[model samples]
Each structure stands twice: as C-alpha cells, then as structure tokens.
Target chain A: MGKNKKITDYDMEQLIGQVLRYGVLTSGIIAIIGGVWYLIQSGAGFPNYTSFSGEPARYTSLTGIIKGLTEGSAKEIIQLGVVILIATPILRIVFSLFSFILEKDRLYIVITLIVLLIILFSMFGGLKV
Target chain B: MNILLFTLILLLGAYLAGLAGSLTGLGGGVVIIPLLTLGFHVDIRYAIGAALVASIATSSGSASAYVKEGITNVRLGMFLEIATTAGAVIGAILAIYTPVNLVAILFGVMLIFSAAMTLRKKHEDALQEGSKLSYVLKLNGSYPTKEGEISYKLKNIGGGFSIMTIAGVLSGLLGIGSGALKVLAMDTAMRVPFRVSTTTSNFMVGVTAAASAVVYLQRGYIDPGIAFPVIIGVLAGAFTGSKLLMRINVKSLKVIFSIAITLIALNMIYNGINHKF
Candidate 1:
C-alpha cells in the first residue's frame, strides 16, 4: 500500500508540475505579445504612474477583460495573460481535489475544498469595494 | 518619461530584482515593491498590485521544479492554504482602507524582518513523534536523499498554521511572497525538514497570492503596463538565477544582498514616515 501510494503521489506531482510549467509558459508568451503590441501603439507616449487613479472598468473585471480581448485591445490582452497566471495556481488546487478524491483521501478532499471555496469567493464573490 | 523608456527601465529593474531575489532566497516581489514606489515614483497600490502578479508568476514557476523533485508535501501545503487563503482575503480588503503611508511603513518593517530571516542559519530538527493531528491529516512525508528516502514527522500543527496566517496577511497586504515568514512557520515552528518546508512554502505562495490577486484585480489595482514588464523580467531573471546558482558562492552573495536590502528598507521607512508616498 505504501509503494502504491508513492507511485500515485509521484504521478500526481508530475502532472501538477506540467500544469504549472505550461500555464506559466503560455501566459508569459501572451503577455509578451500584448506588451510588444502595446509598445508599438503607445511607446512614445509620456508615461504617468505617479498618480493613484485605479484601472478603468474595462480592465478590472473578468467580463470586461473578455470584452476587451474580443475588441483586440492590447492592454486587455496583457490583462488576459495576468488573469491566466493567477488562475494557474487555483487550477492546481482544483486538480489536487480530484486527485485526493481518487485516492479516497476524505480528509484532504475536505481541506482542498475549503481552500478552493475561499479562492472562488475572492474571485466571484464581489470582493470589490 | 516616454512609455518605451519607462517600460524598458522597469524591465531591467524587475529582472535584477528576480535575479537577486532568487539568488538570495528572498523572493522578487519584496524588492519589486520598493523599486516601483521609491524609484519609479509609482503609487503604492499600483506597485503592490504589480508585485502580487509577479509573485504568483515566480511561485508557480519555481514550484514546478520543486514539485517534480518530490520534496514538496502537496497535502500539507493544501492544509496550510486553509489559513493562508482566509488571511489573504482579510488582508487584501484591509489594504483597501489602510492609508498608503501606513502600508509603506508596514512593508518596510516586513522588509527588515525578511532581511533578518535571510541572515539566520537553517537547522533541521531531528525526527520527532508525529502529533495526532498530523497523523490524521497525513501530513508526514519523506524526501529522497543520496542515501535513501528519509521520512519526517510534523510537530505543532496549530502553531505553524497560525504563523502561516500571518504570512498570508503580509503577502496580501504588501504583495510579497513572505517566504521568510512561511519558512519560519514550517521550518522553525513545526520542525519540518528544511528541504520539505522550503519546497512546500514555494508551492503554497502561488495559491496564497492568487487569493489576494483576485481582490486586487477587481479593485482595478493590477495595471497591465506595470504587470507585464514585471512578470516577464522577473521570470526571465529567476530562470537565469537558478542556472547560475550552481556556479556561484550564494552564502556571501546572500549576506551582501541582505545588507543592501536592509539599507533600502530603512530608506522606505524614512520615506513613509515623511509621507513621501
């Protein structure tokens, strides 16, 4: 049983590692593309980061990001990459939940569920002020 | 400054932050915050948002390698995430209402704590009996060494969880990984093996950061212009630094870097007190 559990753990770890690596690579590429496009469009514009005005509505929410992406907005594209990067870890948690269930590890499944719920709450539970 | 030049310079700074962060084992988001606020004259909120994004990137990137090594205890990491994710939500919301100067001062203090952590030596505790909670949660795990697989048992689960909550709050508030605090909880408090604690902490940092990042994103704090350069530069720098790790004398480098970070942290505290932000 110990040997079998070790094998299962190893496989799961490998899969999780692959997920993280691919997620990062894909997001990095998308961000670079958006950044290059942005530079070409507004590279010579005077930059202003000194002020504290928050991001516009179009760049803040998930729907807004998707809408901006459909409209081919470079900044929104970059934001899409950022969104994907953030989701990568959450996806790992979701993956862990399924693996725990497969192992019939009830304790871990509950623990993973709690963590996932918290993350989901942060994402979709209107954490906006 | 034009957008091109600003972006270029930010890229260079972030790359160096990542390089130095990985080399020194301090993590990049810590330095990224000060660089943006003090050097680039960016707003503290925006700086934090960008640093959080970069934190997620670096954690996931490095955790991939560590996870494959089989030293990272995934179940243990998930259990601790319960505390960290909750604390992150609270901290992210708190950052919204907290004054920028106060936040800066807090970040400076955290920087000093992190520097002190880096200078401290790591000692692995001898194997101890596992607590009932650890056994029930199946948190005991082993890692492979040249000799064979060495198993370790966890102690003081409650204490470690409590410390992890604090680490999570700091991560959310300051947009740093707070690896120092996480290590203290797992390595010092719980007496987990140093290798396992460090790798597990790496695994958890991404999820903890992601919890706060959602709030930051909804609040319109994550600017693509800032996050883009930071993410790309820090990832590239971390990759390079990992490759360079085998060739360099990291102990001396860590000492030098920690001192530099201490000086920078003092400057941040002074600026915050003066309301320079």
Candidate 2:
C-alpha cells in the first residue's frame, strides 16, 4: 500500500498551489527588472504605440533574442521576461501532468496529455490565416 | 522628452486600468484598450498587444492567490481548456485575416454580453450534480465559504466546453482577457458554483491568453517598449485593488465600471465601422 499511501499524501493541491504562486512571483520580479532597465535607457520621451511592425530581422527569432541577451540589451531582456510570464501557465500544466503520472491515474494522464497537445499545437502550428 | 512623457502616461493609465478592472471584476483589457486608442491615438493592433500583456500579468498575479486557497479547480479548468485553446488558436489566426471593422463590431457584441452578465443578479448558487462527462473525468470540488465548505457539482460539460472555445477565440482576436465570456460560460452554461467558476476561470485565462499571444509574439506584434510599462503599471494597480477589495462597497462600483466599459465597447465598434484608423 506504499504506492496508495504516496498517492493520497502527494498533496496535489499543495504542489500546484506552489507552482502557481512561485511562477507568478518569479515572473513578476523578472518583468520589473527588465521594465526598469528599459525605462532608464529610453530617457524621458513617450513610447510610440501607434504602429505595428515586425521585429527587426536581427531580433526576429529565439537565436536573435539570445544574441541580444549576450549583448545585455534592455529590450531583449524585457522580451525574454514577458516570454517567461507567458510560459508560466504552460509550466503549470506540465507540472500537473507529472503529478497525475505519479498518482498512476490512467484517465487523468490521457486527459492532461491531450490538453497539452492542443496547447502545443496552438503555440507551434503557425496556421494563421 | 516625448518618449518619457508617453511612458509615464501609459504607466499611470495602465495602473489605474488594472485597479479599476480588478475592483469591478472586469479584467483590464477593456480599460487599457480604450485608454490607448481614444486617449493616446495608438494603433489598435499595438493596443491589443499591450492589453494582452497587461491582462496576463494581472490574471497570473491574482490566480496565484486564488489557486493557493484551493478555490481553483485545476482538473476542471484543464479539461475545459481543450476547447478554449483550440478556439483561441483559431480566433487569433482568423483575426490576422479579418477586417478591422468586423473585429470592432464583434468586440461590441462581446461587451454587451459582458455588461449584461456583470449587472445580472448572481444565480446558480446551488450545488449541481455531476454530468456524465464530469463522472468520467471526476470533475467536482468544494471551497470554504463563510457558510462552510460547500461541495458543488459540475453540470453541462459539453456546453461549457463549447462556450469556453468561443471565449478563447475572442481573447485571442481582441487581446482582452475575455474573462467575462468565460465567467458567463461557467456560471450559466456549465452550472458550476459561481465562486468556483470565477477562480477556475482566472486560472484558465492566463493559458488562453498565452495561446493567442504565441501568434502575436511570432508576428512581432508585441513591442517590449510598449508592453513593459503597461505590464508594470497594471500589475501594480491590480495588486493595490485586490488589497482594497476588503474596504470598499465593491458591488456598486463594479456596476458603474461595467457600464462604462460597455460604452467604450460601443465606441470601438463605431470607430471600426468608420475606419477611424
């Protein structure tokens, strides 16, 4: 009954609760650091939210972002921080999946995996009209 | 000089929007978008992207609080997410091709529903029995209220999932939290306890927004310069508002704010039709 005992005591609520709280807290700190850094660099002028343009080719992809990070650009760091914030929920889902697996819940494992697949497909499908 | 001034204004406005949004139980996008477009003459697309950042920030921030209290039904939220994520991806992708007028009009319709839902007296407070789908998925839970720990049932799983998908698409297309639509689904269509629905919806909104945001991110629609202050301001505002919820007669305030948001949604429609851009 060790496995059964472990399943009941695993305390998914506690585990998931921590994941959410820490995920948000960590992301918040990262965003603030990036935001303040950008604020100082921009001087006193207002940001132009008037236009929509694709990011410059030099900063277009993940590689571009990594390179910019190495250069210590404030903008890249900020972008990276936002990316982390966006990833937080997805992280929670993955954590939940693992928890289900540990509990040996066959039904939940499949359900969680299906949801995970849809999210991944949405994120990566690039099927825009 | 101008950039700094704009930054300050956006920061302050987003802070206020976040505050008002949380206070009224209406997420921040409606407030941020109107302020951006009508107040600052920003493009709708940029406004949408910035709103997305702000909405996700407040949502994740508050969700952390609610999830800890064990109010959020993690399993239920995940199951319904199947529809929401699929709808969101489609809605966002469709948004890329849809004309601005259509988006604006659809936004107006969405707002009308949001206002109506907000003003309507709370019902569906009774504990529901689990549907067949709920039995299969084991979707039910309880939360501690002033009364006691109330165990509730989940009904209408199919309808709830469908509504969530639509809500997801709107979130993607408009870059708003579209939380109102989600709440409506859970409360009315799904027959879950209102408290449970609200908390679970918050937990789900972040993921729905992220799904749509992926598209925006890839397209370079998100601007770090614009999003940074907006995120910072809204997060601060929402934090303050949440703290203040204890001291205020928040229900009345929410009604007034909901009406104001409805008006702004109308304005968005008008502008979209007239091609104000």
Candidate 3:
C-alpha cells in the first residue's frame, strides 16, 4: 500500500533468489564431498542395481540420516545433502509466507499456507501405500 | 563394473542427459530414466528416485536466475501450487502401489508426449481483461519487455488449475519436472503470457517435485550412491546449457533432441512390454 512496503516486497524477492542459489550450491558441495569420500574409501566394490531393493533403514529416515552422519557414513552424508536440496524449496515457501504476512495480503497468506501445509503433509503425514 | 567405474560412467551419462534436457527444454529426468534402465540395466525404481533428485536440483538452480529477472509471477505460482502439491502427494502414493512394468509404460508414454510438445510451435495468448475470479485473486501481473513494462490479465482459473493437477500427478509418478504440461495449463488454459507461463512454471517445479520427493525418500527409494552422481552431473550440465542457450540457435537443436528422445521412448515401451524392467 505504501512506498516503503513496495521496497520490502522487491527486497524479499531478491532474498528468495539468494536463498535458492545458496541452498543449491551448498547442497551440491556436500553431496560431492560425500561422493568423493565414498569413492576413495570403497571404490573397489561393484554396484548391482539390476533389481529394486529399497535402501537400508538407516538411509531412509531423517533421524537415521543424521545418526549416520555422526557415525561418519559417507552414504548418509550424501543423503543429508539430498535432504538439504529438498528443503530448499520449502524454505522458499517459508520466505514467501513471511513476505505475504509483511504485505498483509490475507488471500496470498492463505494460499501460501495451503501450499506449505500440503508439502508438510507429504513429508510427515506417513501415508502408506 | 567397480563402483568407481560405474560412478564415473553414470556421471558422464547424466551430464549429457542434463545438457540435452535443458537444451531441448524437455528436462533431464526423461532421458535419465531410460539411460539408467535400458543402458545401465538399473531398476526403474532406482532410476526414478535418482531422477527426482536431479529434477529438484535443476528446478531450484534455474529458478534462482529466473526469479531475479522478475519474469516469474510468484503469486500466480503459489496460487496454482495448491493444486499441484496435493496432486503430487496422490501421485507419489499411486506410484508406490502400481506395478513397475505399468510405471515404465506410463513413463514411456509421457516421454512421447513431451517430445511432441517440444516440436509443436507455441502460441502466446495474453488476454486483455482479467476474469472476475482472477481479479478477486489479484492474479494479474506485469513483466519487463523491450518496450518498458507490459501487463497481462488471466482467464479460466478453474481450467488452468485442473490441468496443473494433472501435471503434478505426472511429475510425482514419473519423477519428472513435467514443465511442458505446466506451461500448457498456464499458457493455453489460463491465457497467461508465454514468458510468464514458462518462468513461473520453472519457479513452481522445485516445490512440486519436492512434494513427491519427500514421499519417495520415506519409501527408501532415494539411493545416495545413484543420486550423488546424477545430481552433480545434471546440475552442472544444466548450468552450462542455460548459458549456451543465449548464444546458440536452439531451433534446430530442439528438433534433433526431440527425435532422439522419441526413439528412447519407443525403446522403453518395448522393454516394458517384454517385462524387461
């Protein structure tokens, strides 16, 4: 509504862009580090992916991933990188929600909330197949 | 092959897949799946999981650039994301229950459809007046052009939102970005400007993919070994390809890539029929 508010909106958009760029760059670096460590530590083993067997329990959940990281498992480190990548967009949504709140735009605040909630449900709702 | 050899080869293949994906605007996931399944003999489920990670990388990476350019309508993207995220959750669940063979068949079909879309000429239909619903939602926005700023109005919010749901389902089930379908929903159904439709679709894809990716991760499908090389390779390739896009004549390149993708799709169909997956 005011000139000051408009400047904040532009600043928020720039901030969102910065978040995406940095999030992706940071995650890529982590994944690469884990990958290099894995290759160096156990490069001789052969990989057999001809069939579908799900990942081990340790690599499947968020808590398990963090636990593996503390134990110095390279694969879990890579998974942690992936967790960061997935989190990037969710963070973007969080920033957008904040911007909407700043603008006092009730409709977009509600719309952004719906989108964020759906994503949260997919992450934590534990709907089994 | 040993893990070192395998990882190296996969890295190379994924780079090309990402390069060709961004160059053709068809996305890396489409080619990444077939390359993993038919070429490396990897299981389709693993392929899908790796592809999903690559999709998230490319979408988020590029969205950073597009958002700064100010062409992306964040508000419009957020509004449509309500449908997409819900649909993605449903599609990810369906993928878990569906037969692998059927999933391969559907993925092949989607690849063919995507190739066709790339070959078709785009028609920008920016409307002059916003619909009553669009007005209330404040969906109308302006973008910068050569001639100062040009504003556009939106129409058929319901129809566009419906198509976006389908796009989300395809993205979730197949582990693809499904940008073509999202563009169609906005550009054709919603009558958004082509520039806005594309940039906004790019902006929305990361979130949409993230929605389903969470489900995939919980089901233990995201193998870190496969995902590491794929993500690194695709992100690098896409970054290079986007830079090249400004200099190269992409018209001819698109035709060639589409043909190549079509052949790969047909092969996937054959393999699915024979239960070779």
Candidate 4:
C-alpha cells in the first residue's frame, strides 16, 4: 500500500525476465508432448505421402523424398496440415506462458487465459481449415 | 517414398532454416517453403500448412528470449493480438475454401511485398512520442543499448492494430511468417522503438499463427509426419540464430534472401495460374 509501489513503477526488464524463463519451460513441455505424439503416430518411419508411394515403395531413394511429400491425397495432406498447425502454436503458447512466469508478470496470466479462450472457441466453431 | 528418408531431409532443412533464418531475422519460412515445394515437391497448400507450423515453432523459441530481455512489450503485443487473432480466424476459414490458385497468387504477392519491406533501413536515435491510443493502451517501454538506456513511447497503437489485422489474415492465408508486416506496423506505423517493436512482433506472432493453426487443424491441414520434422528443424534453427545474434549481420543477409523469396513467390503465382490439381 506504499506510494512507492505503484503499478507503473515496476521494472519492465524484471517482468520480461520472468516471462522468458516461464515461456521457454512452457514451450519445452508442449514441444516434448507434441514431438512425442508425432513420433509415435508416424512411427520411426518418415511421414510418407500417399500419392508419391507409387509401385516401387522407395524409402532410401533420393528422388523419393521430394516425390512423397509433394504428391499426396488432399484428404491425407489436410489431416497432416491441421495437426502441424495446431500442435506448434500450442507449444509456443505453453512457452510464452513459461516466459511470463519467469518474468513474474501477472499480465501474461491473463494473456494465457485469452489464448485458451481463443483455442476453445476455435475448436468449437465448427469451421475447418 | 521412404518415410524415414523424408523425415531426415525435412529435419535437415528445418535445422538449416532455423539457423540461417534466425541469423537473418526472417524466420524459417523463406527456406522451409522452397524446400517443401521445390525440393520436396510439396503441394503449395500443404507446404504452407507446414510452414505455418514451423513459423510458430521458430517464434516461440526466440520470442521468449526477446521478451525476457526487456526488448518486447508484452502489454502492447497482447493488446494488438486481439485484432490479429480475429483476423486470423476469418482468414483461416477463408483459406480452407479459397481456391488454391488464388491463395498461391496472394502468397506470391505478399512475398514480394515482404522483400521490399525488409530492404528498408532502421531509423535510430528517433524515439518519438506516444500516440493518443498508446496513452490509452499504455504502450511504452525502455531497452538497454550501447549508448546507455533508451526509453521509447508508442505512437500509433490503433494504426498498428489495423495493420496487424491485415498481417494476421496473410499469416493464416499464406503460411508465411508475417514478421515483416508486424514489424512494419509496430516500427513504422506505430513508431515504437526498434527493439521493442521487433520483440513485440515476435511475441504476438505465435498467437497469430495459433489462431489460424486451429482453424487449419479443424480443416485437417496438419500432418503429423510433416509437422514433426519441420518443427524439430525450425526450433533448432531459431536457437542457433539467437545464439549467433551478436555475430550475425542480419540486414545484409535479409537483403540477399529477400530476392530468393521474391523468385519463389513469382513461381508460385505461375503455378497457381496454371494449377492442375
């Protein structure tokens, strides 16, 4: 309650430091989770494109790398696209949260809440792509 | 196509993209998109989806450091994110239905513009006063510098927000990191200090990407295989860039690389014009 404790008087650098610490931690956890999920789902094999598989089933072939990722069924590609889009952002959000915590900034808590709300709304909105 | 090999290639691309992109401050999209389309022959749409995911990863990795260093304005970034996110949702929905050709054309045009923007020089020793909106939104801060401490005031919060809306739409639609536009909005339009502007732009980018990412996810654009390796690479690249921030001559690199992006954008437009599938 002291006059010296005004909100405007708080150090920006201190807040930022807290944000960085918590942000990295938050992102690291999400990345670990998402990376693990992707690894598990794709198996040890590379994520192959359905259209590029052809009759030869070439894995080690140099030409196969370009062929497989480029030419895939739209449906399959779309599925992959969505997964990539969602998981990375969540990882980043978790990281940002960690940064905020590291900075000891309460502001990011609210920002995180808003982000959560946006995610929920986006999830439920029934609009794809 | 061997799954293992494709993953390995993407992992290498991601690593290089992260390292080089960060060193140049352009994010990994410049390298990632071409690698996917030209190198991997990825469909533009899928390539964009992958690029967007990687963009989020790069920003997330680096933005945290920038933010902690007092270079990013969390309040300013959060305030503008509202606009960007709203625009992103709308853009993502549009991206799903927009003819692939149109998106390709737009993407190309955006890349050209981004290149032009990147070539501009930074204005130092010119910290302007805060705008009326900045006063209302409380957008102001300081940063450490060789010259000692430099405090800056936000100039055009509303204008920056407006630009962010457009930037968000583009991010969702094209899968390119809208960092250039975000920086322009914060730096030129809003007249925020350079470091603050760049860091804040970085802070907000993930959220912008997230907005579209969710929509893309619902629309089924994310592939686990592609997303995984790309993320791994971009995160690595971003880390490398941050470590080498002091040593790198980012401006010169951006100049050289912007031309590369312009070429890709032109080719993309050509492909879009004659798209088969």
Candidate 2 global CA lDDT score: 0.77
CAPRI quality of model 2: medium
lDDT of 4 by residue, B42-155 (tens): 666667767877777777778756755656666677777777777787787777678867877887787788788778775455456766766655567666788876877867
TM-score order of candidates, top first: 1, 3, 2, 4
lDDT of 3 by residue, B167-251 (tens): 9998999999898898888887888987898789878888999999998888878998898998889888878877887799989
Comparing candidate 3 with candidate 4, which one achieves the higher DockQ? 3
Question: lDDT of each model, Cα atoms only?
Answer: 0.88, 0.77, 0.87, 0.66
Better of 2 and 3 by lDDT: 3
Candidate 3 Cα misplacement greater than 4 A, ranges: A2-6
For each candidate, what's the DockQ?
Answer: 0.88, 0.56, 0.82, 0.20
Return whichever of 1 and 3 wins on lDDT.
1
**DockQ agreement of candidate 1 with the native complex:** 0.88
Isolated chain A TM-score, each model: 0.95, 0.80, 0.93, 0.36
Instruction: Quote the lDDT for A14 in model 4.
Output: 52
Model 2: CA > 4 A from native: A1-10, A43-48, A57-60
Q: Indicate which candidate wins on DockQ.
A: 1
- Residue A68 lDDT, candidate 3, scale 0-100: 94
